[model samples]
Target: MTTVESKTTSAEATKLTVPSRPGFRIGRLSLVRRPFKVLVNLVLLAALLMLVCINIGRGDFPLSIGHVIDVLLGGGTRIERFIVMDLRLPRSPTGVLVGMALGMSGAVTQSISRNSLASPDILGITAGASAAAVALIVLGGGSAFAGVLATLGLPLAALIGGIATAAIIYALAWKRGVQGFRLILVGIAVNAMLTASIGWLLISADINDVSRAQLWLNGSLNGADWGSVWPVMSAVLIVGGLTVVSSFTLGALRLGDDNARSLGVRLQLRQAALLLAAVALAAIATAAAGPVGFVALAAPQIALRLVRTPGPPIIASAILGGLLVVGSDLIARTILPVELPVGIVTSALGGPFLLYLLVRSNRKASA
Candidate 1:
């Protein structure tokens, strides 16, 4: 062969041998595919499904998984349908959706702040919602007129309070620009204040009102019905969708502000947008199922480790979050003679995890 022809053939061979990048593109958006992450998500999803079936089947009238499936598929007796469909079904979905929202929100906040400790519960977003909802519950009392107002206004009040708290935290954190550590510090302070406010409200409220608000503050799905599930589902579909779509910015932000800016990321605008979405997700979840603690804090980190991703993978985090909550709810309902709130189970599990993270961070810093 001629020298030029030999060189061209070798170059073509090299091109053929080199592998392409592992993701597909859709219009302007490029999504990177990770097989391990996909497998993790699928496994998490299957676990969540299994937990849901177990949760549905185990109660005073214990049905088998097959029986639950039969009831779900519209083949069960009326009593079985009523038992599974009417009562037990709502709680699992509500917990799953709430977990998914919290998980995604946690992932966004942690990624943006570049801090493992940054989550809605720690950062006061959930606290703000809790305070607002408690205030409404206390003020409304048991009077017919006030009760109606509180019933109608509780979710709205929580939403507004969460947004307002996030705005305050952002403003306080913004010294020239919002730093991750500063944001976390500000969030912690705000959360403390909100926690105090909720306590004061509970102390000053009527006994009946306090009773109601206290149950909510503990984050129970005791009263969850189909009514509670739809709002959370809607929020997840809308705000959650927006959060997922905009998450590409998180990669650039993780590389530091100068790098992000170099990549044409409007840093302030993007941060604010992401923070807003995260806050909204947490607030809506709180409204639906009170402040289910630590799901947000734990899910993303667990998912990050599981997926072996530099940043938390949103979908994996979400699925694992669902699994965590559903499984916790199952434990809460079945393990004890008296059912406990799902939040109690999560808190019991997450408290140690949080401490472990803190200890790990401390060790790394000392090193």
Candidate 2:
């Protein structure tokens, strides 16, 4: 297998090295600030902010960006306040958080696997969450949002399901240690079985339950509010911080398991932690938004390309992911008479991108 050398192509990252402090070797923020990186981040952020503004007015009655900001600042008429703060505010954050979570998780997944196509969606983590949520909604006679999942919410169920499924896949793939290729293969099998289960549940479900179940499966943010934003924001802050801190390890891991271990990296514990972290990120996004597709598959790769880095650029991926989701949601809301689920928009974009990656990867391998 050809390995991606842990060499950074960005001259700026190469030059701005901070000396290690005494006592214990502490990691820095590991932020990349190349001119291209800066430009890309700025453009993406601007685009994200633009989309957020646009989506705030995405209902039957649209408001200007000025009006949306006015409502956000606590001075608006009844309808304006209701539209921006109550109805649209949570949706923006939900889409952003979902994208960030999936993007960072996808970066970690691909970095560890050394496979460009390795993402939570392809590796069955999201499928696992989906299946569990569907089971709760359909079989256990429990609601996905209320009932058993009320306290921690469906996100908890999703987290458990995603982590458990990941564990099962890893266990099945373990032969002394987890190999990336083997892990991907096992994940594919698990994803297939779990997808079949979801299909079965959907098919046999009561008519009344079908619409509710499908809505979640489609990953819509129809009624997103502050209730959804807090939990997701908390996850993004805590888990996202950890991802940034640990990104150096992911870069090292991309140099190949043997090489990373040779450098005295704690391979087993680190791998487990990274996997769990990725699962948590994916699970949170899945639970909050119901398995919106493709952000995970595309964000890290897009970040790497933009940032000119050998490994997944965590912060860049997060920003890109947020932009992708928010922008997609904007399109989904305004592209037609009726709003489509953001997931459908992402799938429409990501599907072709994934196919292109596979074809390119195959061509390179053949070459």
Candidate 3:
């Protein structure tokens, strides 16, 4: 090559190597700052605090933010103590933990499947947990054992269901190798069957038991305590932390399975690991919060839109998911005369968002 041509090529290579800076960038408003992330983190923290306050501040004897803080710090009235410390505090943390798991798990599923529509609920994972839990509830089986089975057993069952579901979908989609669209299609079909089964189970129950099962099925944090929170939180944190570290490879996978494999990404091993992590996260979250939907789906999408980047964005999604779930839980508690189920609240918000994503994905695929 000529000297000028080689020089031009080198300059182009340099341009390609330049990393884009993250911040609020707009026409004549390119204010770059390191504290930008800190600021965003602060905003999320503030939102979480505000939601907690709102959650505690409502109900029969509402407490102010100051009072809530004081109670948390061990310096409030007996009434404030009971309301904030005894009642509201536990649910808030459960929301945060469940939300984080959902978000992180959703990001993993989307990344591994290479599809935006992929989520815990869409893949029959939540349905699996819900089915198992509902079966326990409807069978007139009430005990510490049943509760444990519902809370912890469901997640384990969900892990099995999720892994099995993924395996089946992957197997069905394996036209020599897995295809994202085919996997997604099979996942949706499986989800429909599982959901139908759950409906039938609920239908077969008596009126009172049907009501009880409905509450659990709808995904409420109404009576959630720290007892239920810790186990799920521990599982989610371990899985999420490990997955966050593997995010770089996840990003590379977005380039397509073949390209990633050609780059020596060990497509099978990485995918299996990711799918296991994703299922574990979803199961823990579901067990904690009764198949709380849409946080997994909505949180990752919200994080992606906020960060304006492609790939998993697992950490951001986890943070956003925590915020979304905690905030939604707060809303469910305080929005009306009667407390709403957290799952119902998420479905109300997330269902529309899922439809929008579906439409957008279809348009992109068509285009």
On TM-score, the leading prediction is 1
lDDT of 2 by residue, 106-146 (tens): 99999888999999999999999888778777755355443
Question: Candidate 1: misplaced stretches above 4 Å?
Answer: 1-20, 27-29, 141-152
Model 2 TM? 0.87
Backbone clashes per model, in order? 0, 0, 0
Q: What is the lDDT of residue 276 in candidate 2?
A: 95
The list of candidate 3 runs beyond 4 A from truth reads 1-39, 140-154, 206-208
Alpha carbon deviation, residue 174, candidate 2 (Å): 1.4
**Candidate 3 per-residue C-alpha lDDT over 1-367 given as tens digits, one digit per residue, 9 for 90 to 100:** 6999999999999998875665577786554454555566567767777776777677778777887888888998888888787877888888888888999989988887888888888877777767766766675456564555566454565565566666776677778666677777887888898889878878877788889878877888887898878877787668888997787679878899888988889987888788778888887777677888888888888888876667657877888888888777777777656778888888898989999998998898899
In candidate 1 the C-alpha lDDT for residue 33 amounts to 74
The count of residue-pair clashes in candidate 3 stands at 0
Better of 2 and 3 by lDDT: 2
Per-residue accuracy of model 1 over 1-367 as CA lDDT, tens digit each: 6999999999999999876657689998777777776787888888888889988998889999999999999989999999998989999999999999999999999999999999999999999888878878887755564465476677777888899999999999989998989999999999999999889888988899899989898889889999889988988899888877776798888888999999999999999999998988898899988989999999999999998988887888888888888888888888867788888999999999999999999999999
Evaluated at residue 269, the lDDT of candidate 1 is 96
Better of 1 and 3 by lDDT: 1
**Residue range with the least summed lDDT across 10 consecutive positions in model 1:** 140-149
Question: How accurate locally is residue 27 in candidate 1, as Cα lDDT from 0 to 100?
Answer: 100
Query: RMSD of model 2, in Å?
Result: 7.1
Full-model lDDT for every candidate? 0.89, 0.85, 0.78
**Cα shift from native, residue 150, model 2 (Å):** 6.8
